[model samples]
Structure formats: structure tokens, C-alpha cells
Target: MASSCTKLCLQCRSLLCSKTVASTWKYATRAHHCAAGTRIPVHFLNGFSVLNEDQKTTQTRLRWKQQMLYYSNLSAIHQTTEVKENKDSEELSKANVVVYQNPLLPVDAVPVTESQMSLDLDAAAELSALEEISDEEAVGISVPFALPPASTSLRDYVDQSETLSKLVQLGVNLWKLEQRPNVGSMLLRLNFNTDVAPRLLFLKEVGVENSRFGYIITHNPFILTESLENLQARVDYLKSKKFSSETVASMVSRAPYLLNFSVKRLDNRLGFYQQQLQLSATNTRDVVARLPRLLCGSLEPVKENLKVCEIELGFKQNEIQHIVLAVPKVLTANKRKLTQIFDFIHNTMKVPHHLIVKFPQVLNAKFLRIRERHLFLEYLGRAQYDPTLPSYISPERLVSLPDETFCVQLALATLDDFYLFQKTL
Candidate 1:
């Protein structure tokens, strides 16, 4: 049964954000089970828009028809890769991890070699050991004079630069210098690494009247590299591939360049990205689609009911031929929770056009310049979207958005950083 397409909940977000005017996401289309013991027929959040219900047999088929609200994450490692699936690929189910840190030891005292319960104590240790230091080489940003007013914080833009700014703004020295050349960019990276880097966002309206509508937003979008000097090399990596003109332009325009890779917490790595690859197929001619729970309350309900939940989704593909190029070598320091939180944060604000046009294509570019990479694995929010308002935003607010369209706003912020690309205008 095909569920009818409906408008997304933008009112709640606008009321909450009260500022900011833009957002984007990556979506892949593929097929997969919705929830255990639940065959909810809806689009998959990872990317696939059409679920291969044919695969939904009496045992493997979906039972209920639910709408999914997806926020795509283009930066995640696997989503960027095109992994070939062997029907015989091994699947690990129910992998559990237990931690045994000494109660007497402060959380920070747990050593990298010791935190086996957490996936990457080494990475955590690396993160904790990072000192609060600013790079003398600050990069510059040439905005079009009309960057949307900070009326809405970055959280208002995608996740939580809104309140996070409040924390960073407390740093009068850094906050006041943003208008200076290369200062804003340098400070943004600095703030991302500090205690202020761990974002805190509220899933409002989740009160007793709307518990199901609210969910948590995680921090993500981390930079793999620390210096802006790496931007040139990263851009060169993309330009070697010969991408489309539009791809090159967007990347160049957003340059300086920062990785700001997003992560999510997952007990199982294979399980998480598996869904990413499959659901992403919907945008193309994939065989099936799996939907997430984007909406609820029967067609008969007519009125906005609280039974529905909306989730932002993020999906990215590197192309079937280069599928092998996208898989990430295990980061000796990477953590499972970090990855999961990145996913949650990425999707929460991933824009729709991201994968349909930019992500893969940019990788195809022959001349790309990456100026910076911000590695953030922080917590953001747990909020709900009201399924009743407009789904699309007005183009006036965001030149990237469609005209007169009511937009779907993500109640989350990204753990990623704002990447700056370069080329002569």
C-alpha cells in the first residue's frame, strides 16, 4: 500500500529556530526491515525510497505503512562508498559491548588502552588529550555580504550553532574577532574542539502532550585533519577525478575546505551502513525501498495527531564502479558512539539535494581545494518535528531552497563543520 505524500513539520521548527533559513540532506534508496517484529511499509531513512516489498514475504514483508522523515549525512565514511553486496555477505546480529571502568577513576581518567567497553579509547584519548590551542595560520572567508543573519544559530541552520554559539560567544576574545580576516574560520575550528564543542539541543514540544514527537540530536561533523593547509591536498584529491562543472563550482565556493566528518553511535558498524546503502537506492532505479517512520495517525485522523515521529536521514554514494574507494579503514581511534552520534546529527539536518547532485559528483571533480577539516563527535539534541506544517522552506530564506515551498526543518545540529572551497569567482 502506497502512503500519500504529505507536508513536513516546519512550523514547530520555525517556532523553535525562530531564525536561520536553510538546510540540506543526502538520501540513498534501498530495501531493509523497518523494525524487528514490525513490517512498517515506509521509505528507508538510509536512502532507498522504494522498499522491495516483494522481498517482504510472509516472514520478511512489512506489516504497517508509515512515512519516513529522512536527513541525509553525506560525510559519513560508508555512505560515501559504493559497497558491492555479496548475497552471502556475513551479517553480525546483536553485538553487545560492556564497559568495566573503575568507579574510582574519573571518566577522563580512563586511559585509551583501557576503555575496551567503548569502541575507541585510543581515539577518545586522542580527543581528550587535544589542548586548547589556536593555529597562527587563520583562513579567510568572503561571504556574499548576505549570509543569513545569525537570527538563527547554526543549530537554527542545521543543528545547534544557536546555543553552541551562546557557549562560544562567552569567549569575548574569539567572538569579537570573527569579522576579522581568517578569524571567524579559525575560531569556528577552535570552538569545535573545546568543551563547548559538545552540543546541547532541546527536543521541544516533547512535553507530556507530545512525547513521541521529540527525539535527541547528537553532535557530529568532525574534521579529519587539524590544519587549513590540508585543504589544498584534499581539493587536489577530488580534482584528480574530473567531476562535473556544477560539482566543482559548489566545492570551490564552499572552500577553504573542512572535513567536519559526522559520526554516529552504533553497536554494529555493518548494520548501520547496510541500511544507508540500501535505502539510498530509491533516488535511482534501485530494486526496492525501505522507509523510516516519518509520519503517523491514520488517513482518517484528518487532524494532527501525536502518534507520528519524524526522523532526518542522510545518504551518500560514490558510484557503483568506485564503490571500493568509499570504504573507510577502521580508525584506530574511532568510537562506535561517535559514529552513531554523527549519523544522528548528520541526518537531522541533511538537505535533500545533497546526494541527488553534490556529494558523489564533487568526488568526481578534477580540481578541488579543501581548506580545513573539523572533527567533531558531540551531542546536540533530542527533539520532535510536528508533521503538520510545511515540508519545504521558502527560497528567499535560502537560495538553495525551492520558491514558495514550506520547508521541513531539522530539530538537530550537525557535528560537522562548514567547509570552504575555492576558485576565482
Candidate 2:
């Protein structure tokens, strides 16, 4: 028995040596094509050796198979860990951040820093810090005008000057000046003196109502600094054009900057109305009174408007003149607006041209307002627009009434019904 066991042991040792050498040779053959510095695992080589050993017993083969499986599981776990680490590094490199500060600030207000970009930062904490900083810095700075540093209250800044105070008292809306930095600067730059009072009084002397004087000066603050001589000259020129003193005051109250225009500028606009539109003196005066802003702005726009009316809409030149005289605001209408109103009156409502010529105010009404009232009257089955019918309501009566008045006089609906109709619209 001993002799037999010794022989078996020798055989096993020789088999183990031969198998190890064969497996090592196989590993070297597979690794021949691998890049330099690539590592070959020792346990995988050992696994091959265990599988190829000359073990005759079933128990010995089972132990080798268990050892191989253990090494394969460990290898799989290591590969998974390595892949996870690589993905984590990739995510860290691609992170981005946005800072929500005021757009009005200069670039130098918030400098970019490396620490702000770190992955470990708490985003909520950083965003709150940025918003707080923005509020503290963004209060009084304007893009067009550099304001005095807001060390004092805006009201206090206005109170330091007598001119600003008088302007506020004279009816310049304090709220408007406070909101606009440039307007505040304009007020600060004014050369207010006893002359200021006289200029304001000049508006009153010209027939500008006391209640309206403040509103006019507030709207056109430049009027406060206008020369009394220049203002008088504009007033005298208007009188030369046949505007009564009361008419001049009403014009100034309606548009105070009308007095700010030079005499030549006024003449050019007046000439356009007289010669170009062929409006007579009374028509010219009426047009100016009705639409003073038309004279205040360029006549080129008015000319363009009239050209569109005559050429595009196919109206006779006399018809254009009549429209201008009756509703001078028609000259102020933009091309798109004029097209829409003309289309509605002629094509949609089917109103005749003679009636439109008689009451041109229908052309000046807003398209939506016209549609709303017409549809409401049509809804009540009371839109008796046939000229032959006695119950017919004229386009003038249809659109000219105030909402409450229209509800009572025409629709016979309550004010609440009109309001609800407006909401649906």
C-alpha cells in the first residue's frame, strides 16, 4: 500500500508541473499581441492550471471548479467598480451653472471665480446669495443716465432744489419724475428763477385753465424752461392764423409743447394743411383744434396718410379733403389702421359712402369698438341698417354713444350686460 501511494504522489506532482507549464505557455501566446505594460492576472492562469491537472478523483475536480468560479466573480466585481469610477469622473467634468443677476448691471459687477464652479457647492445657497447681492446693487442705476449715487432718498434729492419743488407744486407729476432718472436730471439742470413763475403764468394768461396748467407743465416739463418771448411768438403766430386767444389757450392745454415749436416749423405744418390738403382758413383752424398733435409732429406722415387715402382707397381728392375737414384725426391714422377702418365700413358693415362722408367720425372709431357695438346690436335683432326701413340706426348713432349711454339708448341692456359682453369679446 505504501509503495502504491508513493507512486501516486510522484505522478500527481509531475502532472501538476506539466499542467502549470502548459497553462503558462498558453497565457504567453494570448498575451503576445497585448500592448506593453498590460497586466496578466495570476489567478486566471492558476484557474487554467487547476482545470487541466491530472486529478483522477471526482472530489479533487469539484474543488478546482469551485476555486475558478470564485476568481471569475471577483474579476467581474472589480471591472464593475472601475467602470463606475470612470462614469463619475465624466459627470463631474460636464456640470454647468447659471447665475440670475439683474440684466441692467455692468459686467464688472459680478466677477466669475473658480470656486463658484466647484461640484461640491450647494446650488440653493449660491443662488440665494446672488439674488440678495443683485437687489442691493440694482436700485437707482439707469442705462441712459448715470444717477447721483443713491445715498439719499430720491425725494430728498428733489427737495434740495427750489426749481424741482416749484415744478412739483406747479403740477409736474412727482411720480413721473421720480420714476425717470433723465427727467430728474432735466429738472435739476433747469435755470429756475423769478422767470419760472412768469412762464407758468404766461400759460394761464393765454387762457390755459388753472386746473389744467399743472397737467400741461407736468406732461411737457420743457415748457417750464421755455422763453416767454418764444412762447409769445408762437401764440402771436397762432393768432395770425386766426386762432382766438381762448383757442390758443385750449391748444396749449391740449398739447403744451405746441408752444415749444419754432415759428418756421409751425408755418411749414400750417402750409401743408392749407396748400397741400387745400383746406380753407376755417377748415384749417378746425383741423388744428381737433387734432393739434398732427401739427405738432411732421407733415410728412400726414402727407403719406393722405396719399394712401387718395391713391390706395380710390377716393376723389374732394372726398379726401372733406374727410380731413370733418375728422382731421383721419390724417393721423396709420396706413394699416386706415385700411382696416375703410374695409370695415365699406366691405363689412356695408355702409354707404355718402353717410361716411357726412359723419367721418365713424372712420376714427376703433375697429374693435365698432365690431363690438355692431355685433351687440345685431345680437338683439335691433340692427335695422336698411336705409329704406324707418327703424334703422345710423353708423353715427351706433358707435358715438358712451358705453352706459349706448346700453340705455340702443341695446336697452343694463351696464352690467355691456360689461359682460366686453369680457366675452
Best-performing candidate as measured by lDDT: 2
Residues 64-171 of candidate 1: C-alpha lDDT, one tens digit per residue: 222122221221222223232222323211110122222222233223343354544544565333465345422332334333454322333223344345433432
Candidate 2 on 324-386: residue-level lDDT in tens? 888888887878988898888777777877777777888888889888888887778777666
Candidate 1: TM-score? 0.15
Q: What RMSD value applies to candidate 2?
A: 19.5
C-alpha RMSD for every candidate: 42.9, 19.5
lDDT of 2 at 405: 90
Candidate 2 structure lDDT: 0.69
Candidate 1: residue 354 Cα off by (Å): 23
